[model samples]
Target: MALGLALPAAAQNVDGVVRPAWAPSGLPDRVVLSPGADAARQMAVAWRTDARQADAVAEIVEAIDGPAFESRARTVDGLSTDGVVRGGHGRYHTVRFTDLKPGAGYLYRVKGADGWSEWLSFRTAADEAAPFRILYFGDTQNSILSKGARTIRAGLMRTSPDVVVHAGDLTGRSHDWEWGEWTAAGGYGYAMVPQIPAAGNHEYSDDDDGRRRLGPLWAAQFALPENGAEGVVETSYYTDYQGVRFIVLDGTAGTSLDALDAQTRWLDRTLASSTARWNIVIQHQPIYTCARPNDTEALKAAWEPIYRARNVDMVLQGHDHCYSRITDGDGKASGEARRAQGAAQGPVYVVSVAGPKMYGLNDRALTQPDRVAADTQMYQTIDVEAGRLRYRAYTVSGVLYDAVDVVRAADGTKTLREPVESLPPLRLCDGDVGPDGAPCVGSAK
Candidate 1:
């Protein structure tokens, strides 16, 4: 039988332009927007592209009138390009735009060898103490695309946060595919919101081919504050925004007790000197874990006292793929047990996860934490108002699972409130799997 076969138009091939079949099918990936010192004045951006277009440049413009606010066009400084071999070959670049006015929206584009990327837009943070929102996620290291991506996307859709905080483990490994997954999970939200990432254990590797190092992709991906400790540059640093101060610490450095000692001293000085009303500290390891053993004694012995002495508001951590809100400083339940122990004010330690990896809750988690969750994917949104902070945790499906509000009275006493909100089932597991056939193994001791 004679059949008339029609073939689709052959893919267009242009001379001198290299495009890989499996490269980022869409626009540039891992787009990040960072606020500069002036908020309204300066900002930074980073993104990844396919290897074919290694030397790519970015175009930025200020949006003015309409909802799009199309403004004048200008070119910003481009960063050095590097090769990333993931599922295939890829390239990554970063760019920084300075001298911008505070609290202004800027639209940008990336020009590659093949074509130019779409116009991505971002706004600088207001230079003054204006209300803003931030999204916090933890341990998006494994199952990034399948399970973690949806949670992150949901969080972004639910709350158009001004900035995002990664507690740690942005990728399972420092490989190209993992990085691609990380950026994909974030998607366009990364470009819209500035990212503040902490260094986790997964970000480190041992020396094998003399190429092993700590935080290789981190420095290249984000333009952070450089005012960290003397030797610990990228791993440990602090940034100030509006009325808050965020201090990040690195626990991987083991030069000696001297290293942690130096960090402790720096932390004390930073907290003591900061005039900001809110002081939040971020790190990978939790001082009080709900899934793992109590192994943060070194940090506790060194930094906890400082946090308490300085009235630090909150301490956020991730590494144990679970959720916990430890308040009252007792690290114990808020009943007779705490009264018997006679505890006082201390920093509220919260350990949470946003990815699919699940861990069974520890035995102590049952009564020790004021609120706890196990074997679940979750994210946190924290809203800071004048003398009041509201924190709410949600499941991947946008269900409000847990919530707490801390109101600081004029006398400096913080009060906690649990509003009457219907939450999902507690969903705790005793063994490796829950009734829903999901693995819930607790953290390794």
Candidate 2:
């Protein structure tokens, strides 16, 4: 069968698209793995199929030394919702894996009309504070099938990540074809490791009633943890994995729900209740912008104090199509993360993009960002250890862009350690053209 079937020209993307395959659903496409409320003992998988499948079941078994593993498998019938995604009618199936054994390998597959899907494997998080790694992406919102796929695939090849974090804008639109293209770009990698995605502006669209709605494909595409702040449960949620407490937030504007107040209280409580050694926040829009001249002023006014009072370690964000790392509002580059004695640590805010769309750096990026880049595709690898956390940013070509380490002491204080190393010369666009001499793929809006 073809990897992805093309849509008739009439159904071609309204805006330009790089990856443009649609799922017809004899077999499942867009298979993705996401962490459940508790990562150490539970996970979830979501996939799409044609309406012909009235029901679907997921079978999981512990992976063992031999092919007889199927004999001990357990089956769970997942919930399915049939809907129209931009003119395509299909069913989205999701199953929550309960009672999973921590730090153990498990194999699973989904059922379709013809047969079961090829076996896929995943490992649960360790039971306690232990070493692990997470891959963070800014936005794969455009040219996902072309330029974005390269960086996503490159990161997977470089490190075996235990969890993936997406700072929203997974697609330019909520159309199913674009969603399929996104899943195809990640391929099995999305199915193998758990992904935590925050909602982005592009993921929302006006409904037939003229009411704005969270991308129809969202809550359906990735089976995200539902344990979130009240009112925004579908888009704002949290997941505890290894020694990290990862909070997913919904900051998208003009959606049906008003998230400002409800999410603010939730943020305070969520951070106050954190028991994990590492606390990380993932939001699509930045409280501080690197590409846009205006900051997310509302977000900063409401949540910045909460983040600081809680000592949140990192803020992973997207929605600017540029890259930035700032430690505070002083406009001074965060020269080193490892601070000297008596210096308190603050959340190190990072904004980046992985998709083909690139935007020029703004004034804050020029003066405040410890690191900044333009017209480049990048990926970040975060290594989580019991006493320390290490971070590295690499361009799609695999050259290091930035590196930092946060060392945690027994008293819960963190010191910074920024590596001193030279990377490939920074690439900045020459007006509408890129440093490589090709027309810049980013819109520079």
Task: Report the C-alpha lDDT of model 2 over 120-173, residue by residue, as the tens digit.
Answer: 889999889899889999899887776688778887777778888999999898
Across residues 25-131, which tens digit of lDDT does each residue of candidate 1 receive?
33566667665534556667776666666665788888765655334687765765565422224566677788776678778877666677778777776666666
- TM-score, candidate 2, is 0.92
Q: What is the number of backbone collisions in each predicted candidate, taken in the order shown?
A: 10, 6
Query: Per-model C-alpha lDDT, please?
Result: 0.71, 0.81
The top-ranked prediction according to lDDT is 2
* Candidate 2, run of 10 with poorest lDDT: 1-10
TM-score of each: 0.85, 0.92
- Error (Å) of candidate 2 at residue 332 is 2.2
